[model samples]
Target: MGRAPNTPYAASRYSAGGDGPVQQTAFIGQAATRRRLLGGALMAGGALAVPGLVRGQVLGTPSLVPMRLSPDQLVDMKCCLRPLRAAGPNLGTESVGGKLVVHNYGHGGSGWSLSWGSAEVAVGKALASLPRSVAVVGCGIIGLTSAVVAQRYGLDVTIYARDQIARTRSFRASGSYTPGSRIALVEPAGPQFPDLWEQMARHSWRMFRTMLGLPGEPVRFGDSYAVSDAPIERRTWPADPAITESFATAGLPRQNSEFAHLDSRIADIVPQAVPLPPGENPFGMPYATRSSQMHFNFPAYAAILLDEFFGRGGKFVNRVFHRPGELADLPEDVVIHATGYAARDFWGDRTVIPVRGQTGWLVPQPGVNYSLRYRNVSALSKGDGIVIMNNNPDLGDMLGVGDSMELPNRAPIEEAMATLAAIFARSAGAAA
Candidate 1:
């Protein structure tokens, strides 16, 4: 890994030392030490420190909810390949089969995160042609959102899909607010996409805010604890010349190939991430950070979308298109393609790659409201279930970087549960 880029936050003493030529890890450790001393000083003086300081510690046996993730408790298993594209999402227009088609697919894992905003863009293009009736293809998050937005735009929108939300790949999503997760290959999307990505994320976030506190608890926010037993490594991500060159043929420069940090750009909008003090770490892990995160309970959330769509006079046609020519049979002059991975064969899109993800679900624990990702395994405790996904093999160094398995592998699920059980076992030992 290269030296971290000299961003203002990265240059802070807590990140990289303010002094010249400091090793990033050593400087961060020093900052952590300083925070520990400060916390101790406040405790010795009998002075009531900040509200978050005492409550956030997890080093000791804090009132942390134990996650019951034993193999016997596992209830379900599901997997889906994220429709990843190198150039972000394909929000473009084309005249196909005498129809004004607005391509709005290829959102990757961020389809749910960017649905509203991407639909806004696609529908804007559709509206430019002054079409009275619009056809939305697919029924995943992107398709459902596009249909709803089109209806809101005063168009008679009809959704054509082979499968409903329950059967679609979107149902398998982890339902986190991860806008950049496999959104685009870092190089091919170029520099301009970061701005557009932010716009979409911000718009969808506003909509998500409105959905919060609604019936069924479809949209909600919760706390998460990130615990790591190993030393935190910081990498100065250098611009890849190969990626730059690849995008150059597509009219993009190397400097413009990297995706900008959305966290830095929208710090005010998202919840603030706070590091836990030494004694406050409850997970018995060496490093820990706790923060609030937005989550979409997908099962309930998808049902609400369908309910609202039907309530608003939107229509759904149970149909599937085998190829682009089949789309012409539909009775709409305008078509919005929100067909996730199916676009590969339906529209002959070679860039639509299938990146397989294997996941397991445990019986829901109402008390375990928080989520955690440790050692390449992630667990989210939604109302439906405790969704667990293994990113890599047990004790593996790296997660699935370019994995493309489209089929389910039961072995990963078994490995994930075993690893999760071990983590809880270790925590039990520490607590006892």
Candidate 2:
């Protein structure tokens, strides 16, 4: 049916059509022809899509931009807590200061990923109130997006924030497409949350797709590899009971009671996870998977969102609200509350708590264009910098569950870089 490994116009094994002597000579000739074809393909920046070829055996030409990372290469670090809400991002409304306040904060770690979808929900509720204008609190992803969405809805939008997008907590994110990362306590958010989360995630995915080829390549998707010494078993959400216990967080929606199972819900939409054949494994690890994911280059993306907001006649007011009464001072009667972690003190929402996340960056390396995760350490090559973050908490027992230390943790950064150094060493050895 198909061409044989070393034969042209090859006959099927079951076929007895070819004369044995003629077929033997043709096979040898085809081998040399194939080699010539391969050489030509490599010269043209292409690889033969030959079926059944193992991955490692035929390495592609060296990467155009060579990169080797070391522990001492670390240049900067950013840290922030995901403002987790027990009931998920508060997209509904609450009455405050004689105005309809649309709660759009507490998206946890999914702020950048879920901004568009959640903004849509928040604006829908605001428009329903038939307000002439809207006041958006905060200038992070949620606030910026909320302003843009409001402008599109024909509402005069004004953003009030303590810091602009570049300095906001949202900028501290790793900028991955994790729409449901600790978004809420499963039990408190209720069975209905899956539908809401799915709706937001799907909508956000559509919006992000439209920005693929824009200037700065603000939103991007690229290949990523996950490697491990042990089999990378497929895990369903609410991970094994014991493992879930390790993720146990403290707070209103206690980890014991609110373990979220949202990851599996949107698995069908995100890049499909597939096991890599031994030949395809890049890390030379026993187990590995290759996939692609959407990553936000926050600096570029933030600039785009901010520019769009300003171009649409949106106003930015550097105002901070410390309490609910501050809402009365705003010129508009409709408000979108996207203050994120600040909601704990400003709006008196005790349900909001922080889950600390930290990331370190090596100076920008424009050539490296891939991401890798192994042994709980992850790295992404971004235009702003080469991001390296340890997903596992530095504290021995916390596992980063409910822990919310906002300050930078140097130990984890050191450990993460050490792991990457080892990975690069192994990779160099394999190449040698």
Candidate 3:
């Protein structure tokens, strides 16, 4: 009982009585091994009855696999991990000089999507500061862009973050087309936030438009298409409570609406924003509208933005600021909090939930000019001509979102590949 279990072997063999079935089993195994060596098919004991696809050095693997987005499009969560909660107190309160503390963080998955618009809102308040020095917390898109706007105003600005510029989540983003109204306006009041919405969007658009042809930087102009599966009667944002509470911008034509609802606002701004002909929409999209999402090549864009900031005599300090009282140490008069989701802990403001949105990208579709989407599903072939996304709307916030939202549901990437594979599959005449 204390020894190894032996089935095909006899006790007599071990007792030195005679040769036994154990030898026969070993002999059979040897024979099978020899046969496998010669036949190029190997058997593992009695477990397997047939060879598997991976068992041999096969030829010609299919270019794509189902539910797998552009294999070329990969995201590493390690580069984009934000602590689920702040370990200490919110560090962005108190007056930097004589100005008020304007908090602007908690943008979860929509950082890239709403960067320009959100930054405009934050910067609008910052500009009102009239402080000679402005301090921006966190080093992601919002902070960087806010700092840029501050610089444009000729204010001496400083950036503080636990990490550096390119190493932040903004760099790892799958930045695609902008669905602007993604931000949740937390106002207990009624339809009074539209004016600020209009102001923010228009400014961000103008700001982004101004950067259209720079020599490869953060702000870019690239054609983006929104192909839909159905007619978009996008729900309108009745009103933004925050806009009302913050800016008193009520009833000025700003609403939380879908893309089709506000196509006119961005028509002239986006290069290819136009209605798609009925024949081009396969997902049964009742109407199609195209726009060039403010293309942000994180690598080049974020680098250039930060580079320009630093080059322009901006000061950046590398320190983990966990409490607002800690800001007193820095010699600045104003602080613009661009801490992103970390504001949850820093400010103790739970109003900001990590609205887990995701985007999937393809390798690059050079000549592909149109952005297409059916339902929330979308596609782009530039620098990877596909982008798919899944947000917390269905699944709720991503606690450990890190960067790769493509993990459990494989949301964005799967949709991207299936879409491309489907289109090409049709072009190649493959069955759905």
Candidate 4:
């Protein structure tokens, strides 16, 4: 018989008849050789199916950006209340002590994300009065953006606030483009609100694009990974009795109250999330997904907005308004009331609910540029610092609903650091 070609898949040929130890030894050797070839072929096929595994080993896990996760790394902690209104942001004009007050506050957690768009609405209304000048009530992101928008229309703008941008609650936010984050209760906001939300989201998205390549990367995109041990499924609102009762007791939105999710409306403009294959998931978790998110670097972003406002002949007045009537005392007949959560008490608007949010800042790690979420905790490595926050998917927006505590809590951040530490440790062990 002729010998077969020396290929992994080729069949081996043996003599038609064989006897004694010499023939048996030859047969055994051929069987062993065939087994080796078959095993090699299976391994080669596996390598082709999962190139990421081979590349991961060679490239040292490109997806797993190293982070120094520890409580000791926490340099600062900030707590702020997101002003959530049941009927969405107050964008309508109202007569306040004879002054045409255009309400632009109560954006909840979507203030930064919807600032420019909301500003367009507020400023447009303010301009209709044919006022030569305008006054913004707050110095937060919404107020700052609105003032800048007013300036673009050639309206001399003056910001009257007790606190500047740095001291305002907006400065403490986990600055990200979360356009629909607890913006409003679906039923209370009505059908028209979503359209308004889309308008604002699209406008703000376009405005953010303009600031992308600016100095200090005030607005930039980064990859975010959501890692989990369980298989990723469609997230649903929690129906747990305890959670519902707590929300009810706190006078917050119930579990059944759906929050407006308007992100899908602008999906074309925003980046979509994609599931990560097993071989590509570097988080050491069973399931993972990645998406790009826009982040606002507070110091740089605030500075640029402030610079543009002042460069356009705008002014800031260090004044505190104890009542809505005080707005009429301002020189400008048209005013934009962008007091954010403060509008709840100052404007006597009970619809504005306070949702407490806290973030811990860590020393900046230039090498780590990605963001991650694992075990109810989220971490984003920004140019200024690494921001870590407690964001449980199960709780949804209800995580901080009805909590007005502005004092920073160190315990939650410490717990989040520990969770991150375990994640990184397991990843390191897997790599080793």
lDDT, candidate 3, residue 421? 50
TM-score of each: 0.79, 0.82, 0.61, 0.84
Could you say which candidate leads in lDDT?
A: 4
What C-alpha lDDT, on a 0 to 100 scale, does residue 99 get in candidate 2?
84
How badly does each model clash, as a count of residue pairs? 10, 2, 33, 0
Instruction: List per-prediction Cα lDDT, in the order shown.
Output: 0.72, 0.74, 0.49, 0.81
Please, what are the lDDT tens digits per residue for candidate 2 over residues 1-432?
A: 666665554311111122211111223347667678667755664434221211322222222122335666678788898888878888878888798888999998799889999999999999997988999988989989999999988888899899999998888888889886778776678889899999999999999999887888888886777778888876443423553332235454433335465767778879976888864565545677878888888888988888888898888899877788879888899999888988888888878877788898887665566787887888887767778888742331124555677788778877877886676556545544
Residue pairs in candidate 2 whose N, alpha carbon or C atoms collide under 3 angstroms: 55-279, 56-279
Q: Write the per-residue lDDT of candidate 4 for residues 134-248, one digit (tens) a residue.
A: 9999999999999999999999999999998999999999889999888988877898999999999999999999999798999999888888888776576645666544332
TM-score rank, highest first? Answer: 4, 2, 1, 3
> Candidate 2, TM-score vs. the true structure?
0.82
Q: Write the per-residue lDDT of candidate 1 for residues 1-432, one digit (tens) a residue.
A: 554443222211111113211223223334455467547846774212322112212113234456666678777777787777778899999987899899999887788889889999999999998999999999999999998888888889889999988899898877878786667766577779888988998999999999999877788887777767875443344555565344335432223224333445667788866777765665655777777888888878888888878888889999978888888788899999989988978889978766667678888776566787676677888777888887743313113424566567777777877776676666545544
- How far in Å is the alpha carbon of 287 misplaced in model 1? 1.9
* TM-score head-to-head 1 vs 2, winner: 2
Root-mean-square deviation (CA) per prediction: 12.4, 9.7, 18.7, 13.0
Off by over 4 Å in 2: 1-67, 236-257, 393-398
Candidate 3 per-residue lDDT over residues 224-332, each given as its tens digit: 5453445544333343455442212331113332111233455565455556564332222245555555565566667677787988788888879777667777677
**Candidate 2: residue 395 Cα off by (Å):** 10
| Residue-level lDDT for 355 in candidate 4 | 89
